[model samples]
Target: MLSIERTLLRLVMAALLIGAVSVSGTVYFATLEEFNEALDAELKHVATSLARYRDLSDASSAQRPAGTGRVAEPELEDSEIETFTRDAAGKLLYASDEKVRMPFIDSEGLTRVSVGGESWIVYTARHRVGYAQAAQRVDSRRAIARESATRILPPMLLLAMGIGGLLIYGLRLGLRPLDAAARDVAGRSARSLAPIDCTRLPAEITPMVQAINGLMARLDDSMTAQRRFLADAAHELRSPITALRLQLQLLDRSSDGAANAAARADLQQGVDRAQRLVEQLLQVARTEPEAQIAPMLPLDLGSIVREVVEAASAKAEAWQLDLGATLAEEVPVLGDRSQLLILLNNLVENALRHTPSGGVIDVGAEMRDGRPVLFVLDTGPGIPKAERERVFDRFYRGGQPARSGRAALGSGLGLAIVKAIAGQHGAVVELLDRVGEPGLEVRVSFPRR
Candidate 1:
């Protein structure tokens, strides 16, 4: 591909060359026409002046007689000009050059004739006594026109060269910003997604720069989210793996059957915890902002709430907690059923894990102000207002200790997944202290259709 500067220079030079040629050709033809006209007029005037001397036959060759209708001949400094006179019988009377003789023709204003192997233009004027003719060589007339046309060449060439130089310089100057931008991008490390500076960019290139910057910003955000996810996964996986290792060691050391069985149970619990952690991590990944969510369909929020409550009731009973649901009409919302199921499961599981035994955990849905709102209310010790926002961060357990006091077996990704899924459905999730109660209420509000 050609460089922009070279291409622009080529185009400009071509235009200038064409223009110069056109102007030169036009001027050459126009000058030739005007020169021919002037030559013809001079020839006619000379012939007319000579014809005024009607009695040329009576005059001596030395001088014209006084008052004999004689006209003083103009001195011919140019050797190319020749004049001659002829009588009625076509006999030559006098000639400007002794060797020069005018060509004979029946009648003529101007005519071309061959004289001594050279082309000449002659003009003839008839008088009462004789005819006079004035002639000039065609070669001399052509030389004058050629000289006038050649004079235009030097200035035109200089002008074209000067303009070409200016054009090249202007192109380089105009493209400097783009060159700077390319260099800036090339010099960056692969990890760098920083925006290219547009402070001094030209207006024509500003949109392209802005588009590049926008892509850089999105890539930076995606990379950041990926890094955070990996770190959180590593941190969250370490504890359960360590616990599983310890349980295996205990099982190996146990000699008695009771001790072996206890170790086996502990091992199974550790495995289960690790498995749950892995599942939550996967859920968090699936719900990432960059991930494509499952397609949405119109779903009944109330039915979804009831289904979650029914599924978790057995687990709630095992923990001696009351799991129930309140359906305040068939709350309709548009969402991916499986993702909403995951969202609801996380909310209820979080409530069950945090709430103490015999605590009441209620899942419900309702339509409020033309929008569907789903909520989970737990009778557990609520999170502090200061820690509410941080709880939505991946692997971030709130500052408040778990109500059960035994090490909580919950992965901290629950609320993060909840938040992500809510956002995917164009819903807002908020954690607040249950009104007039010492518990937490998590609410998801969906946009109205």
Candidate 2:
């Protein structure tokens, strides 16, 4: 994995190094040019001094008059600067070295030439009678330039090193909050899901921190609900299992045929009830918000209602109630097929269990106000408006027995499971009174796509 810290440090270091090298190189070249100019000026001064006399000897040893306070002109040294003079017609009149004479340039300021296998700086000038020239060794002038330019390095190097050290330290200090956030996350256990401290955190990191906090908050809620569901499920299962065991014992101990037949019948009923409860519990778990479910697909609400009513027709008949469906022509919505089916089944099953024999039950799908709605209505005394919301709570058996005898899931898991499934599908479940009838209408409204 690529690390943010190392990449930042390397980029900054590279920029500093480049900047330092650029400054040092510019100073070196600028100093060298100035030094060369000073040396060339000195050469011009010497060449003009030679133009005053015909040859080098009188110009050097000639003394100023005895009473004059001024000193005699200084003699030119041949090793440092060679002097020469020529007439206008190119006849050599005075030569510092007679054997190796340098030819003059057509126009003069400064020029380099070869003399006796060494490079020389030769300056030439026009004189009243003839032109004079002076020369100096090129190697000598460059030696001075090199020494002066090199002095710039030590201070520049020290400054670069100091700046580099400061950069590394500043980077470490500036990035400390990100490291602290990582450690905070690493140190947390399942129970400790508090948000990370955002004080003094950089703006670039804020969005990522907020996202993590949101996920942890959701996880905390899921874990809490799961713990509660497990506790309630365990409590609900214990009574039925205990009753089944006692019924089995009663069947084993009964001596008369009539008593034995009654015990068997009661035991069968208890087993069937336990099976339904386990089924409902599984449905609730599958509909949990954290579940990894199949993607929801576009489906027809009418088609789903028809399927559920058809499947429950036999169950409804056995309970001595009328079961029917009324569906719109095109009630399309987005939903997970299996979960929506589970939602409808729970509502219908509870209705069948609670409604008196000969009562009416209707399932239907239709569009109202631009949303798909499914409804299950029973012609039995409906849940009071006050207790409608409470029925969605897990294992919420009513304070009094329902219309028929008791709730199918004790009317507990059935409605709770229905609510959980509807929430996952972004649907809402409502309990309303049937118009003019002493019954309940359980309506599930699905959002438009």
Candidate 3:
């Protein structure tokens, strides 16, 4: 239930903080390593200078052994003398300051030395009077670098906080459109299905807005269809229901045998009509989006077609219309059995209702293009090319044929229910030509999964 902006801002801030912490840790470590290398190189250079001086001084003293006592040589600079010393076998000799300890490595025999604090290398060699050594303090540099790096983090953290706050603020502003869109959706009614505007939205949310808008459009169509069906259903049932009540009253009040019989017959007809209308209404309601579907089972399309043909046979006989199934072998399909039956019954009933007396109605189901195709074809006045699409719309009946004989008794929801059923099953239903005659052919194709 969090607002879009707050949620987005919080997420972004968390990510930034994590990244900053990680980068800071990496930089601190890398800086420590670089400082250690630089310090080691500097220490080695200073040590090398001292070693060269020691070699020169020692050589001079050796060449003038007699003059060493007679002629006094100027004292060498403190920087050019050894702070510590080792013998020929590399044992510790002496120290100048407490800070000057034995070289990290043994300072005798080998040309290079390595050794402590974290280990460092020292270089040493033989001279005429004494041996000289060059030492490298790699660990001292590492310690200083680590300390400086640790010290730098607090300021970096403050800067990152400021930058992160600014970025989160900008992100919230950039995402304002999504917030507005969410509010727009929240404020809408259960019946409202209008599309949201996306022209002024940010690019990041444009596609989401567009998708919602498209869904809204479809919902609008569905709602419109539902409302229309309800209105038409009410209209269709009202008259018959009223007639049935009036006929029942007359039958109850009647004294004569002939009058009572007539009233009873009228009441029965009205009741039948009302019942049919109610059943059709229920079917239409099942097509609504909120309607739940039962689990699908393997049902044969041919069996459904045959059952519909058989159920319509009596009505077909009354109209003097021939109704029979021309199905091949069982055409297996995965669907809800009762729903499929209702679909086929509606289609076949619709065909028989429209076809003229002596007209032949062919109900068939077969496999075509690796899909199950169920069709109902009848020889009657066919729908025009312009009105074929309109006929599938709920409560839409063509001008010429809708009011013909008992066809006028229909609730006009039959074709719409058929279309809905086909759509639910991921099938396609289309009206086509009945061979060479002037009649309608309704073909429903259900693709294999």
Candidate 4:
């Protein structure tokens, strides 16, 4: 379908043509009318003059020739009038010898006359003298005027046609830029996010060009971010996998029972590290937009934190470390319950792993600024101020373990998982010092959606 602007232009041009044709037709018809009126008047004047000549000849009893010379000494007529006469009742009384063989005068005031073997209109009128009438030729006058008009019509029609064609051509030429712009956009591929070249465009299209450029820049940024994330994830996963393979090869040698048992334990530890890395990778992938995770619903943040604390306490007991929790009554937030639980579990477990056998781990929640604020505080070596932000990155482990006497085996992705889950739930994670002491405190806040 044509757009409204094109359709409107078409209608306007059509109306212009109609107006032009109508005006031309009216002027043409009016010219013909004026010619007829003048012809009629001239015919009446000729008839009146002829009638006066006839009355003079009748009263003098002398035959006066229609085209007689100035000398009046003749006793006989030389040339007779080439005219026709009719009575008041329109009965033909006489006609010239040239028209004798043809019809003379008609009662309807319309009749043909033959003069020198050519046709003419013999228009008649009654004279004031008794019973006598006169007529004159009106044909030659009307024919000349009509012939002049016929000669002028063709050029005027040609001019109108030329003007209309030029208008259509000019309109199409003016819209060429718009057509070119459309083709430029449609020819691009889905992965092509380059800016368009609009250096020669008209001023009206400047805004459109700017808009397309802005969108392209944003798409390029998103693509670059995704590429960086993939590269980092691959680097993190590769180290553990390579170590596990080497450990497995050593376990294959069973030279001595004690040596074999030690090798087996080392191999099992390597396998465990690899498994944890893979799980964290999957969790990060799931948090992405393309993962198709369902929308979050209202869930109790406090209860979820308590559950993670209880689980971490069991692990702490096995390691001879103390685990404790101080959850507020009910800290409700809008989020996926399972994802929130996963986040809580990772944070508590991370604290327990870094703390020594005699160190303490505490989990708690409180309401702050109408938001649910959950924190995991541990009596372990805290992150340095310069490296605190870097710790949230995937596979980033702190330089020193919080436990003074021992080290914890970790794949270094637990805090990374906590950050991802918090981000998905529209929350923020912050690192702080626990009560201005030597321990680290991780605080997560989920907005009340």
Candidate 5:
């Protein structure tokens, strides 16, 4: 749950700390090694000088017991350096300081020895008379190493701290665009579904921003469609409900049997119109773009058209219209059967209602350009080219009057439902004037399998 800037800062600080520790450890060990080597060299040089003094005939005087024939301590820069000489009989002869006494060591070269319960690095050299030794305290060597580390560590720590601060500041500055994007989203109203700005965005975050923008665009479209459907439903339902109410009022006031019967019939007709309008409104809502379409399977377009024609036969007989279908082969297509049936029914019903008595309504399916094409050709007053587009809109009736005076039979949602269903199947629906005729040809061309 850590913020990006804090996470980056933590990683940078941890790296800096590790680097500081590594550098400090390297410097500490190197300084310690060099200091020890220099100390050992000084001890050896002093021991050699003292041995040479004894070889120059001072041995007889230097071989005496402790506190006798004392030699002046070497004029070394470090006062911690102590010098002494011992005889072959394991007794100290020459002493640079009277209080400094060390165990007699006959071995040569550098070695650690304890004097008065303190550790020192002693270097011994044998002469013709006795042994000469030079020693330095272990504690003094440790103190020098400590001073060296102190001198090197403070600057390293300060540099690491400064780098860490700068890294944190840089991380914060780099993430400012994300912070601004979040604030922009937070400040928007609930109704605001506009896409977020992607300009100046970092490449790493651009994909996320684009996805968010795409989701917002889809949401905006869905909400707009919902609002439009609701408004249209309310507007279309108002007229039938008002007419039904008036018819009911008239029936209630009528006392004559004939007048009561006529009012009752009028009321029934109004109720039927309202019920049909409600059904069509439900259909329109069901076909909204956001609604999930049923899965499509391979279906015979010709068979579907024939079935629709058979189903509408009774209505066609009542209207005295010839409703028949022609199949150019099986004419296979990929579609949802139930939805396709609804589509055909709506087309045929629209054609039958618009066509005059004795007019022919032919439903046909055939292959065109390696795809299935279904057409409903009606011998009726076809929709003009200008009004064809508007006819497919929800509850939109044509401006031209119906030849059969049966416009009221339709709720004006037939073509809208057709268009929606066609869209779901990825089909193209077009209304065109029938060739060499005054009728219309409505075609639904589906994609090639």
Candidate 6:
């Protein structure tokens, strides 16, 4: 629900508003201070001017008699400066207003005084004969300061509004690239796993776009692999189903009891081969996924080889093949237990299926060069050097495994499954011709812990 654009816009406006308020408040206070300073200076000037009249009165009294000359005053307006004079003996000599008397002080300086219950800024001057005081009402002086300071608000408000407009325009223009990137991503479909345009994108957004493109690329690959597996499974299963139908028809047409019995046995063999192929296909499907998600646990490769040999011993005996395992005490490996089990089972069964009667299939696991190694060797006609690599490819049963047996040669997924599981566990599988023997040795080497 949160929008980046809206949040940025709000923050920009909020800062602008706060700045405007702060500037306006500072201007208002500064203007008020200057206005009050001018008023105080005016009060001092008027009080100093009144000193000339007191000196004139002293001259007249000296020429004639004491307390004879009256101090002449200016005809001041009621809102203008109010004047008062007192002699050195604290006697009122003259007053500008008969009712509104300003308080007079002995010292000469600016002062604040309450006269007739109203505050005034009064300035007193010490003279040769008396003191002269000039005062102005505080409320009237403050009104002038407020009026002068308020003139700034209209222009400031207008400027603030204009800048806000510019801010909105700038924000819209700056965010256009982000909108374009969003649109580019929004237009894609499931079939289009192509990457986003990173060329013009901001540095902050480039990494996220790359991560999304990577995920989509992986998904596309997984889907493609699944499709290929389905196609291969359908192609391989069709042959067995058709053969089953043909075998059933032949068994129904046969009249002799012995011929019918033979047909039934062959049909059963076909069923077994189909069943094994389906099972191996399922294992192939399960193994070809991303291996990082698998629950790989530490296990002994020796134990895996021994367990697989024991399970396949009866099957090997039924086919007249000798099955056995030679294992070390501990050969540690990290791998999915079930998948590893399937991998070993496939290698052992592949040998059992291809090795002829009276042939020995030797399974072994041990540590070599600080790495765990599992190998299966059989005394059967081995794979050709050229075909060894291709044998591990899906659905590629090597060109007529030259062994005489009815244990079913293979559905071709055995070594392929083995290679896949080993690869998932970071192991390398090699199809090497047995030394001093006529057989193949499938050796799998796992990375050292």
Q: What are the Cα lDDT values of the candidates?
A: 0.84, 0.78, 0.72, 0.67, 0.85, 0.79
Q: Is candidate 1 or candidate 5 better by TM-score?
A: 5
Q: What are the per-residue Cα lDDT tens digits for candidate 5 across 1-449?
A: 76877787888888887888788778777877898998889899889888888788654554566665556546567538888887667577767678877878999999997888989899999987779899888888877777777787788889889998888788778778888877877876659978889899888778987897888788888888789878888988888899988999999999999999999999988888888888778777778876788888988998898889988999899889888888877899888998899899899989988899999999999999898999999999999889999999888898877767666768889999999999999999999999998899999999999
**TM-score quality measure for candidate 2:** 0.70
- The candidates, ranked best first by TM-score, are 3, 2, 6, 5, 1, 4
Can you give the TM-score per candidate against the true fold? 0.63, 0.70, 0.79, 0.58, 0.64, 0.66
lDDT of 6 by residue, 1-449 (tens): 99766787678777776776667677767766786687678777777777875676555452333244434545335336777777886566766665776655887898888877999888898788877788788887666556655776677667777877887787777668778877877887777878887898778778877888798888888877778878888999998899899999989998999999999998998898899889998888777766344778998888888789889888888878888888767888898888888988998888877788899999999988998899999998888888888988888876764446553547878888998888888999999999987998999999989
Candidate 5's TM-score reads 0.64
Model 3: which ten-residue window has the lowest total lDDT? 66-75
State model 1's lDDT.
0.84
Which candidate number maximizes TM-score? 3
Per-residue alpha-carbon lDDT of candidate 4 for residues 1-449, written as tens digits (9 for 90 to 100): 76744675678667766666665565556765775566545455555555555566653332334233322221112112235444445444444443343343434343556655665555554464422222334444445545655565565566666766776676677667767877877887657877788787777776887798787787778677578777877887687778777877777866899988988988887777778777877777777654677687877877887778776666789888788888767888888888888888888767777776788888888888888988888888778999998888766787754444224456567787888788888899999987867889999988865
- Residue pairs that clash (backbone atoms under 3 angstroms), model 5: none
Off by over 4 Å in 3: 1-82, 87-93, 97-120, 134-138, 190-199, 252-255, 314-321, 355-359, 381-386, 401-404, 436-439
Cα shift from native, residue 308, model 6 (Å): 1.3
Candidate 5 or 3, higher TM-score: 3
Cα RMSD for candidates in order: 8.5, 7.0, 5.3, 11.7, 7.6, 6.8
Better model by TM-score: candidate 4 vs candidate 6: 6
Residue 158 deviation, candidate 3, in Å?
Answer: 2.4
Residues 14-125, candidate 1, lDDT per residue (tens digit)? 9998888778878888987898898889888888877776555444552333223334578456426787777676676667766655576548589999988989999988
**lDDT for residue 41 in candidate 5, whole number 0-100:** 93
